[model samples]
Target: MSVTKDVAALAQPVIEGLNMDLIDTEYIKEGSKWVLRLYIDKDGGVGLDDCQLVSEALNDLLDGADIIKTPYTFEVSSPGLDRPLKTDKDFQRYKGDMVEVHLYAPINGSKLYTGTLHDRKDGMITIVCEEKEITFAEKDIAKINRAIIWN
Candidate 1:
């Protein structure tokens, strides 16, 4: 398995035990250094204490497992307000919220769309934009994320 997947598997229980969902895991190199980032979330939200707790526990588990050979910095944090909606559960949870969708190719001369996420069913997502309900196949989407409207 890939390093990210391996680390995610090892970290899943630790995060879940703390009553948080593991949003995602990424292992990437930055300036010749490897970084392992874990995105976690829960109802209401996540806080620094949650991140620190998960980080400490995962650090111990990863150190004991010796999963990665090279030196890497570990980080645990929230996915943030504009985080991508990656799974069905995420789509369901964010129903009725505004979202920004980027398509792999332009549809009707547009590659970007901002709308209210109406529903997700059978590999398709329905969004309401300008009083019209538009549906797009999940495969055609390059990215779909919550649109944070800043005041």
Candidate 2:
């Protein structure tokens, strides 16, 4: 299993116990430094205290688990507004909200789409764009993120 998976598996229980959802896990390198980033969330949102709590707990757990041999920085954070919606819960939660969709290949001559999220069902996602509902197979989507509207 990958380090991100391993760490996430080991840390899930603790995150749930703390009443937070583990949004995503990323194990990446930046400027020759390895970083383990855990994105967490709750009903309203997550704060610094929540991040610190998970960090402290996971710090102890990861240290004892010895999952990574190299030096790494551990970080716990919120999956901010633009974070991708990867789960059914995410889709349901964001229903009726504006979202940006990127496809693996162009659909209707466009690789990118911005619309009101409608629903996700049986491996298909439906969105409302320009008052017309369009459905796409979930597999065709490269990513779906909560749209950041400046106005």
Candidate 3:
């Protein structure tokens, strides 16, 4: 298994027990250092206290678990406003919210779309844009991120 998956697997229970969702885990080499970055979230969003709590808890577990033999910097943070909608739970939670969809190939001469997320069912995703509902197979989507609107 990949190191990111390993880290996620090891950290999942601890994160859930703390009442937070583990959004993602990324293990990457940044210059001369290895960084283990974890994205976490909760219903009303995560604050510094939440991040600190998880970080403190995971520090002991990770140190004891020795999941990484080499040295690495650990970080815990929120997924942010533009986080991608990856799972059924995410899609359901963001239903009726604006999202930006990027497709692998153009549909109607366009590869990008911004719309209200309508539904996701049976490997298909539906969105409402311009008074019309557009549905695409999940495979066609490269990503679906929550749309960050600026005033």
RMSD of each: 1.2, 1.3, 1.0
Rank list by lDDT: 3, 2, 1
Q: What is the C-alpha lDDT of each candidate?
A: 0.92, 0.92, 0.93
31-144 per-residue lDDT for model 2 (tens digits): 999999999988777899999999998898899999999999999999998999997778877899999999999987999999999989999989999999989998999999
Model 3 per-residue lDDT tens digits across residues 1-151: 8888988999999999998889999999999999999999888789999999999999988889888999999999999999998877788878999999999999999999999999999999999999999998999999999999899
TM-score of 3: 0.96
> Model 1 RMSD to the real structure?
1.2
Provide backbone clash counts, one per model: 0, 0, 0
lDDT of 2 at 22: 90
The segments of candidate 3 whose C-alpha lies over 4 angstroms from its true place after superposition are none
- Give each model a TM-score: 0.93, 0.93, 0.96
Residue 144, model 3: lDDT of 94
Report how far residue 77 has shifted in candidate 3, in Å: 1.1
Top-lDDT structure, candidate number? 3
Report how far off residue 60 is in candidate 1 (Å).
0.7
